[model samples]
Target: MRHRRGLVRLWDYAKPSWRRLTLALLCMGVEAVCVPLMIWTAKELLPPILQSGQSQALRRLDLVALAVLALGLLKGLASYGHYYLGNYVGQRVIQGLRGDLFWHLLRLSPRFFEETRSGKLISHLTNDVAVLQQVLSENIAQVLVTPLMALGTVVLMFLLSWRLTLLVLLGAPLLAWVLQQMGRKMRRVTERMQQRLADLTSLFQEVVLGIRIVQCFNAEERERQRFGAENERTFAAIMKGHQLQALMTPTIEWIGLTGMLLLLWFGGREVILAQRMGAEDLIALLGSVQVLITQMRKFGRLHLILQQGRAAGQRILEVLDLPPEIPQKPNAIALPDIQGHIQFDHVSFQYSSGEMVLHDISFEVRPGEVVAIAGPSGAGKTTLANLIPRLYDVTSGSVRVEGYDVRDWDLASLRSHIGIVPQEVLLFTGTVRENIAYGQPEASDEEVEWAARMAYAHEFIVRLPQGYQTWVGERGAKLSRGQCQRIAIARALLRNPRILILDEATSALDSESETLVQKALERLMEGRTTLIIAHRLSSIRHAHRILILDQGRIVEEGSHEELLGRGGLYSKLYELQSLQARGEGLE
Candidate 1:
């Protein structure tokens, strides 16, 4: 029952395709029947014509030959049906699994990505899905249909002559024992091969992403050696898997050879001495022997294939069965159109370490208020801002929007109301217009232009040879860092979100670009709840209020002028920035 439950769990993920799988099985059944019919035709047709020299037997032979030919045609047609329908079912199952995996990964908390490598996650998405494809298309047919055909062959052999059938069946127990052990070894090697393949994929992605770093450090030789080592390990694993698979055929064939020799010696004595078997019966027994051998060979191959598929199926199942970290309640309420009155009430957050990143951090931003959070590098300013969008759940308190806790609102509704412009500028490979209007796909050309203008992106975008139609290349590589930031801002602007988050949005720009971006920021901040995490004192100088954070606590909070007068942490930071701006420090 436990094993049955495990298989049921695997198949449950291939939802709505049980009907297609049924059709594939029906086709396989037709093909299975054709095999025995063709064998029986050969057994019953030829002998009478050879011995009797009767005209009637010749006519019977011709009729049986035509029937075998027709069955052969039917088998060919069924084979095609099996391939097409099985492939269709496999593709559908993979599509559904990939879609679910992708959706789950995208919705997972940011910390998930922080701890996981991009390459490893990508391996799960691509290699793991391909493994499932192999299982569905190849292993499913073998597991379901091959064994039935083998069993039917054995039963038919017994009906023809129980003595010969018993001789053949004598080896089945020994064969089963050998195969069961081989299957265990195959499953182990298959899993190790999959793990090594994932490692290779992860290395490939990391190298590509950090190619510039590799070039800068002149570490090309180091990277090549690293990649070569992983590739060698992957190669060794695959060779081991193939070696295991290769053993199945010869080992099973040797067992069959021993059993066949035993049957031939004993059955020949029965026919020659006892006169108990007719020529027709001898022919039938020969055909049955050949058919039984064919079935055993297929069974051996099926066992190996099944083991391969089971290994991959188990891996795919691991990801599909990952319980969602933040699932919506059945009766979850849809959030109303937000007014952007954001409040973090006694909000405390800890990373997986249980060490606090934000400790009892409480703050509020009224609609149309521009609030700035300033601190040293590890002061949790960004973490506090992240809670507004529910990127991470507060450990012990509530982050509310318009009086409702974020956890109570549907995830999509809560996220749609907020737009975040991260410190790192990420843009897909696409035209400038598409990149700018990324957040709101249906935005009109005029709307896109308006957003670009507000972000001070239109001037440079028009300066490019292709203007808004130009490709950004991967990660907007063709554009400068400042250009990418402006494009990101344009995307957020087009969304027209109720709340805006700027995480050092101007940190990458030059003085000229920064000046333009600051103007754009002023326009963006108007009539919206804005949370700014800034290191540059000038960027948040006009903020309605500023909060200084230190060691996960709000050490100081006030207006820019008020904080300066009080001479707290904010005052010290401001003084340090002024000294640097004046070139009073060593330069």
Candidate 2:
């Protein structure tokens, strides 16, 4: 039942190209008829050669040769049309399907990305889809042509000798039963092989992304062993598939050959002793049966290709079937420019695993206020900031912006007015100007340079080989940490967001870079409602107020001086950091 549904979905993708497929089928029909006609002509030529005088026989031979040449030319033309049209339709369908898959993936929520492996998704887009393309372009022609060819040959055989045709028909059910059982096993084996390939892809991606860590720990050999083990498993699954395929072809051939030998014996005796049919008639009958057997063997091979395609199609559909986690309301309104007031009212949040990360969090930041949130690691500081942008919906209560719940606002409009600068900045492989202008693609070159100047990145950017056009390597590998952070700031500044989030933006930098980045960040926070999630106590000293959290709830809320005087968790944390800065050992 599942396979049936998959085939129906595949047909829907192919429906737009039905006109080309119909033409290909017509060519296949012409090709099928030509095979039987050629055999009948050969049978008729034999009697004249055996019974006529040399001159008459030579004349008959010349006419038959001309007839065979014309049929061959027609067959060749039809074959070309069938192949070219079939592949063209296949490429068009795959192009449409691949495009839709990518577009759907972009709309999925962050939670889906967190739970799914990036490598497996990549495999679906590339490897699995390629398998379906092979079936559509190559196997589809044989799938349609073989059955037509077989039917035409069978009709010609019955015309020559019905007795021999009936004997051949008796084995049809058994051959079909064998094919059915072998095909079921092949489908199961191919499905397992595809999964193994996906696992191999995921492991390879993991190693490449973490090559730095692997080299630091001297674990190259260990990673190699891991990859080798996965490769071995994939090999095993592939070998099992090959074994079934190998066993099936010969099994089909033996059944077909056995039926042919039986027919030859009966037909030979009738011509030699009973004189019921001539030798030329027997020869023609055998020739038609040979064509039928060849078509059946081709059908057996097509079955395997179809099963592999079904397995691949199933994987691609699985991704498309996932419902979007965060669906927007039908009447959601676009958020307009306003005072940046954000309020979290009795908010509690949890993940898909049911572990609550925030509990009864109630806070309100008035327009243009700078509120810093300080907490130990895993204290839900980042989680609280993520809620403002609607990256994750609140499980219980509501988060409102300027007197409107975020859920009531259009998703794109809501996010456009917000900017986040994370600790580890990610820059795409592009020029400095392009990265800065990412948020506003239509921004003028002058505007990009202006944003860069405001972020204090213009001076260093102009010194590079290509100036603003210098290519940053993957993830900004070519640039220093401070340079990447400054570029990120410029990107946010280009958007001119009303609200900003700084999640330990300068946490990983040296003192000099931190100072430069801090200055850029100060300029970014002016007149914007800002949430600062930080662990270094010194950074938040100038903030208007600080909110400290522990175990998913607010433990302290006060100004920097007030929190120091309280001698509570905040005081203890501050003292510990102060001691660490002085190069003192913790007991």
Candidate 3:
């Protein structure tokens, strides 16, 4: 069920910037009081100025006007002050949330990324957060001030003439009814607006990120159609919201005008008959009526703003309420200096659907031992490697590093001891030196060069137009896959972690690049406990042990020669590859 959560929850973001919020409210309060106070002062002096019937009395009227103008000037200054403080608080809160979201994303399990679309998550972080910002800084600030202003105007009008005020008062319930219905409609529409906007943002993200794929697959027209449909839906939602609001302003104004006309006929008769009220009192009453009308119109619009803000606030609260899936336990012990002993003891896991990905797998690697895992596509080789880093806790067993369960160790210290090179080498747009030194940001120039040379990337980097200073371009699109892989290897080497996992580190490279990367890998794996996930038989030939995985279990385990000699699944795979290499057809 979609519950109606309000602005009280939205104020949680202001906790970090409470001082700014307080100052903004203070400014708003001062302005709210000033509006009616200025009106009351205008009403007070007008009687004396008109009845005196002298030039000096006209001077008093001029003075009263000047005082009213000064109050208005103060109100303008206060409005600016309110806006400045509100926006400052809003921006600070947004910055805090963004920082937390980025850190949390780094900690999420790899499966989290697989299930959640990147475009949708990006929409949450960017577009959704921005909508909440507009609500917090602009609309919410007005919500606080407008109600006080409207109530103040009503009270002043009542004091001026209770009789006419009663008639205006009669319309109050009707106005409230109008606002109530419109606010409810606006809230519903606002939620739809936010959802549609997120869809639009996701569409744009998908199109931009997969522009190459879209073009290659001749899906340009299809994507365009999809995006246009999304945009139309967004436009429709916005128009529906505005349509309700459009009715609001005109209806409130017409009601206020009807009250004003009633006041003119009734109050003018009181003045003409020389009743209890004077001409000046009638004027004051009319003036108060004018102030009431203006405030009521503003009040109606404020309802729409508040409803929109409330809807936005609810969306933001949902994100803030999502408990971290992997929170640090209280008093978690810091991991000791790792000697890279890793063990997976009867580890088992499944996806959210409970379809098992890894069975009761058990394995151990001593310090400085090299293990290679080969598998069919659906086997759990990658899952087993991931368990060591504590990316996902085992469903039934334990993964330990250096004798301590990874869950008991400080997550930061545990991750710091491990380095990983993924199958997809994602390079950011930065200098070659920067990319290589990413793993060890504070590494000196000599250390960077040493790591790059070990990875066989230094020679090619120096041969480029700007040497180490050359930009890699977006996702390293300017560099060959081999060059990007070499840089990734250099980054891992610079980290000099106690444990390293290379997932198909050289699979995409040509033979020449593979030879270079292999030499670099040899240097990198020298003293570290290394686990390699490989498809090519030659990559695992030198490993001390190789485990062949199929259907989430180890089907074969031995050295490459032993596996071949066994003549099982590994031998058949090897034979198929040997035949392909010799230009023989598959049977």
* Best-performing candidate as measured by TM-score: 2
State the C-alpha lDDT per candidate: 0.80, 0.88, 0.80
Q: Write the per-residue lDDT of candidate 3 for residues 1-587, one digit (tens) a residue.
A: 33435445445556878887888999998898888778777775867665787887788888888899999999998899899998888777667666766777666666677777776577667766776667666767777787777777777777767877787778678877876777777778878997898778767777888899999999999998998888899999999989987987787778778767877888888777748676666777777667666666566666766555555556555655555566677777676577999888888888776789888878888899999999877687777778887877788889988998888888888888999987889887888889898878899999999999999999999999888888886744388888888899999999889999999998788878899889989999999999999988778889989988888887889998999999999999888777775773333
Tens digits of per-residue lDDT, candidate 1, 1-587, equal: 33444467656655677787888889989887777667666667757567677888888888888888898999899888887888787777778777878888877777877777766577678766786677777667766667666666676677667877787677677777786787778778977997898788778788888999999999999999999998999999999999978987788778777777777777788788876665566666666666766766566667766666676667666655665667676675576687899888888899876788898888898998999988888888788888877777789889998788888888888888898888888888899998987878899999999999999899999999889998886744388888888888888888888899999998777877889888888888789899998988778999999988888998888899999999888888888888887884456
Which ranges of candidate 1 are over 4 A from the true structure? 1-20, 218-249, 279-284, 327-338, 473-477, 584-587
TM-score of each model, in listed order: 0.89, 0.92, 0.89
Could you tell me how far off, in angstroms, the CA of residue 458 lies in candidate 3 after the best superposition? 0.5
Candidate 2's residue-wise lDDT over 26-133, tens digit each?
999999999998888888788787887888888888899899889989999999999999888888878877988899899888889888877677778998899889
lDDT of 3: 0.80
Deviation of model 2 at 507, angstroms = 1.4
lDDT of 3 at 329: 71
**Candidate 3 residue runs with Cα over 4 Å from true position:** 1-23, 43-53, 221-246, 327-336, 473-477, 584-587
